[model samples]
Target: MRSPASLVLLALPFTLAVPAPAAGNLGSATTQNGLTAGGCKAMTVIFARGTTEQGNVGSLSGPPWFAAMSKAVGAQNLAVQGVDYPADIPGFLAGGDKKGSAKMAQLVMQAMTACPDTAVVMGGYSQGAQLVHNAAAMLPADMAAKVSSAVLFGDPMNGKPVAGVPAGKTKVICHQGDLICAGTSTILMPHLTYSQNAGEAAQFAATAAGM
Candidate 1:
């Protein structure tokens, strides 16, 4: 358990930055072409941003996660992509953006097919985590097997396992007081600081990817 002092410290950033900045802080709005055009790297991360967050990959968790992952396994080996989808609140209310989730699944297939040997890491934060779950559900069992690891933060569907992906390959990180993980829509202090978990998530992804 985190001490009270730690809790206060974690809450500071969110307290000041109520609505975080856009993808420019971390990534861009689209990577549909980026991944397909570049061929393949040693690894690929297919990420989705949260509701109301700017760009395809939000500023909060995506950048920090990618940076840490690159450090864990050389940057030369890593290629990142964000699932382009309308990340509005309504989409989250509807159990993640259906089209967005489909797009994510499509991206996964593209990765597995184009570079079957490339290590694949799937991830998302908050509503993005919902996309991960929805996307995995769309993949065939054989295709899903190629995904090396998946990491979700502030997941609304916390208790459930990622569909078709083995339990061991997935890690859902929900802060102690995150209401979203409890199946509520209310955003709390815990949900906003998932970037702090980047290192731990990156290590898990790296180990799972065998990098």
Candidate 2:
């Protein structure tokens, strides 16, 4: 049970040189998502974003996107968490770096702390998906056990498969016509592309229901 303040301190050392906005806006996305001083149990969902042109999480694409998806899944009873802090391609490529990974891990932990006792479901679009995938690997064993599922959209983790992700609970969804799906040279992976008709949405809905 690391306090939020202490976790921030632990995360500072690994933070990169990228310019962070004023403290007031650091968790602005969280605030806009309607997360206050309480927690919920239905499901705690974390939404990470892809590379942003602004390099900040307070963009229109991040929060609004999560809200839309939240409604689509009928997650009203679920506690939704948004991690909109933006990271560029360079930042993503540097994702495996110690600090970057720690920061991501810290965010996940904070989300868990905010909704202790709830099932956790981590989801992201494109590059955001990649970060969530990596963060899943960094989650503490006990916390990892609490993760009900992880949904990755648009982008894959390239070559590195996360080891701690609960088997049968992790899923990948990509756009069939999207060029990103073709570049994957591997098989036997649980991959569902948009070309699979409406099945992709159904799979996601099913996973959410289970959570």
Candidate 3:
């Protein structure tokens, strides 16, 4: 099994610039309703968005990184879902949000329950990554077993690893100079550049999802 550090290194070369999608393409209206609408799930990628003061869906709209990821996953005929949560600083600094994480975990468990044979791939960015890690770690063993892989970007908790995800099945992507991952760049550009890596990251997520 490759260590998480090794996976981050492997992701470095693919983290190049790509044209940004139109602002109109940010995400789908389906996000407003979240994942509970219920459909047969062959595969699903649950993404928790980064920090926001907005309600559930937040303001982190489409042309969003997860939308690109969903497109890639969809090419493989896999379904995709975005999780809506209070991804705020207060939630993170509190160590973890009992209500928010529990809600996230519940959605995950529901997905697992509804799609017993479906492979689940979960991921997040920045604080959202931390939330996914916390939620996945809190899942019942059987539910956790259903999750095939986790892909995280600019995870603030990179140094303090989460407990549930096995090293082999998790991939972390921190840009060369992204300060969030402890890189030296003093700018937020690195933190915001994940859209450039959408294609590569989605491909990685697909492989992790066993497609």
Instruction: Point to the candidate with the largest TM-score.
Output: 1
Q: How does candidate 3 score on lDDT?
A: 0.60
Q: Could you tally the backbone clashes for each prediction?
A: 1, 3, 4
Question: For residues 104-131, could you state the per-residue lDDT of candidate 3 as single tens digits?
Answer: 6877787788877676777677666777
- After superposing candidate 3, which stretches have Cα over 4 Å from the reference? 1-34, 53-64, 183-187
Q: Which stretches of candidate 1 lie over 4 Å from their true place?
A: 1-34
Which pairs of residues collide in model 2?
Answer: 14-99, 57-84, 176-194
Each candidate: what lDDT?
Answer: 0.81, 0.50, 0.60
Give the 10-residue window scoring lowest on summed lDDT in candidate 3.
15-24
Writing each residue's lDDT as its tens digit, candidate 1 over 1-61 gives 2133433344344534545444332322222234755768888889998776656777778
Q: TM-scores of the models, in the given order? A: 0.86, 0.60, 0.73
Superpose all Cα atoms of candidate 1 onto the true structure and report the RMSD in Å to 1 decimal.
6.0
| Regions more than 4 Å wrong, model 2 | 1-38, 53-75, 95-101, 158-160, 181-211
Quote the lDDT for 129 in model 2. Answer: 65
Model 1 quality (TM-score): 0.86
